[model samples]
Target: MLFDRRAPYDFFSVYHVPDVVTQRQFEAGIAASGWYDYFEQVNISGAALSPVGALLNNVALLPPTPQGPQIPPVSPITKQRVNVLGRTMTYADEGAGVPVVFVHGDVMSSFLWRNVIPHLDGQRTRSLAGDSDKLPDAGPGTYAFATHARYFDAWMEALDLRDGVVLVGHDGGANVTFDWAMRHEDQVRGLAFSEAITPPFDWEDWPAQMRPQFQYLRTAEGERDVLENNFFVNAAPQSITRMLTPAEFTEIVRPYAQPGEDRRPTTDWPREVPFDNDRSQTRTALEAQAAWLADTSIPRLHLPGVPGGIARLGGRKRRLISTWPSLIEAPVPGLHWTPEDAPHAMGSALAEWLRSLIN
Candidate 1:
């Protein structure tokens, strides 16, 4: 259940399961390919990270590595599908601790967290020189966010994981996390939202002073042009995009453009919307989610950053600020949006916030 930037068609969704016409059992596959030496690395996290001011916290944890032939069957890289509402949601897990699920944001799969997982795990080893001890890079506790939209809520319960859990959500994912937290607050120890999102129709219109700074709502030609003029045209980095090699540009844009296919939709959406091309409905849905979580009164952690330009105008002004009052501002107001933008001014402030959590 690892995340990859593959097309939704490449992803096997629960709605349409591929028939096991001639399936090779896991055992059979293992027997045939005895040369199993490269499973993914796992991390075991051991410290609490302060939510304030770090672009990325250097977490102390073990990392997961792909399995080798000599590794036993129950090695860290092993993952299996458990039944959830009669559907099989595959998950990859490692180590043992309070379960924390890693959720991905829009245009990203759980793959984004692959690097962060290693930074927080809690296992270690001592150097033969007896100089110091350090955690190995096997991985942290089992963290997975590998299901499509509908099954996520149910799957969380089926896993019967730790009683209290911490969840991390970014961008579009904040929508899902917000809904789930409201429904299952007892299960969530902490909630985190990055670049908070809400449906366009759901947000309070920008104050008139800020209206010209943003243009949204495109259900019609007039509104569409408004979004195109203020949103897409300004949002899409045509200049930077054209500079990329054809392959590079295509790989990045294609997923959002065609999705499952030019006509096929994926990830719970009914139709494959060429949002990269359409750029419609996205803001609408985002605004709705944003409205719902507009003031998350719960204790939470928020880390927000993205490519500069359009996102800030179209999204940052309304979404980020509207979404995290309860969690972010209330907890840490002193950190800057971009540490690089004001590093010197925010150095002690950010470090103090992060070091507090790490300790």
Candidate 2:
């Protein structure tokens, strides 16, 4: 029998098929059912095992584990603090090899990469995810993208990470990554972005429904929403695929719990968005970044979530791929917060791309 006729519950719960079943029977049954080949291909391609591969590997009846190469047990993530730009910066540094620096976007800290970091090849890459200075409790400073980029530089200098660094960014983090990379192009080995803010950010490009919301964010009413009502923190659940458990939601909003100027980073980041023909420093930096992204020879990767949040509003993906010479597109299924929803897919694609850079 393909599955244990005696224990149907075991098959459903633990994916356990008794060893008494012949390998051929199991393989035949797996082949008869589609998706086996898809997982096999994902494994063969050197990406981390998908959810189905995890299930197949649990079966004692299968010989020669089908889930590609074995992944080492992920080490527990430990938070470390370092003084950067005269302020204490929190970051998670684990594994060892070529450095892959992960920069998170607005309203998120290094915590965002908790699931994604382990998917990287621990043997071949060192993962560094830093909480920017703008985040609550990270110390006071101007929360502009340029200031954040400078802090990124200082943090790297403090760590002595001068060269051969791969930058991975999301949302506001992506903008910081682009700004930092543009200034220190020689130090960056590769770039990866998900739900990022790229160039040609015209007001007309924004979706009609989102325009009013963004416009509101640029006003005093938006400040009240963020500071007093905790709008962004409360609305975060709507951006992702799954509901955040009570503990999860609490942990995410913990930093911003206190009211007052501590929440300025959350508010200021939205206003920094370059809409229309604005002549702000943010716009100037992005204009310069656009030119660099177009001409740079460094390998670039763009992982767009299917029907992504921000990048999906306009023809952002199409424009980015067309403009960037070395850009590689890898689409994962999710919404805005891909790391929260499609962690495995996002991490696998990131790992595969990072591997390509080194080999």
Winner by lDDT? 2
Worst 10 residues of 2 by lDDT: 41-50
Residue range 1-359, candidate 1, lDDT tens digits: 97574443432312211222212243346456753364432222211113322222223121322221121111133345667656455565544565556555433333334333433345221000000011123122111122333456766767764356656564445556766776666766666544444333322332232233233322334233422233322222231211223433343344345312221111222121112234444444444445655554555665544222212334534345645555542221111122222212222332233333334
Model 2, CA-based lDDT? 0.72
RMSD per model, one decimal: 19.5, 9.4
Give a tens-digit lDDT track for model 2, residues 1-359: 47564532322312323232443466567678985656542211222333433343344232322333222223258979999877888889888889899998888777778778989856488999987544445323358887788888899889888689999999889878888888788988999988777666787655444566678777788878878878766766666654454655676787678876667777777788887777888888877877788899989998886556666623764466556888888877556787775667789899998888988
| TM-score (C-alpha, index-matched) for candidate 2 | 0.76
TM-score for each candidate, following the candidate numbering: 0.43, 0.76
Candidate lDDT values, in order: 0.37, 0.72
Which 10-residue window in model 1 sums to the lowest lDDT? 125-134
CA displacement after TM-score superposition, residue 230 of candidate 1 (Å): 26
Residue 256 lDDT, candidate 2, scale 0-100: 78
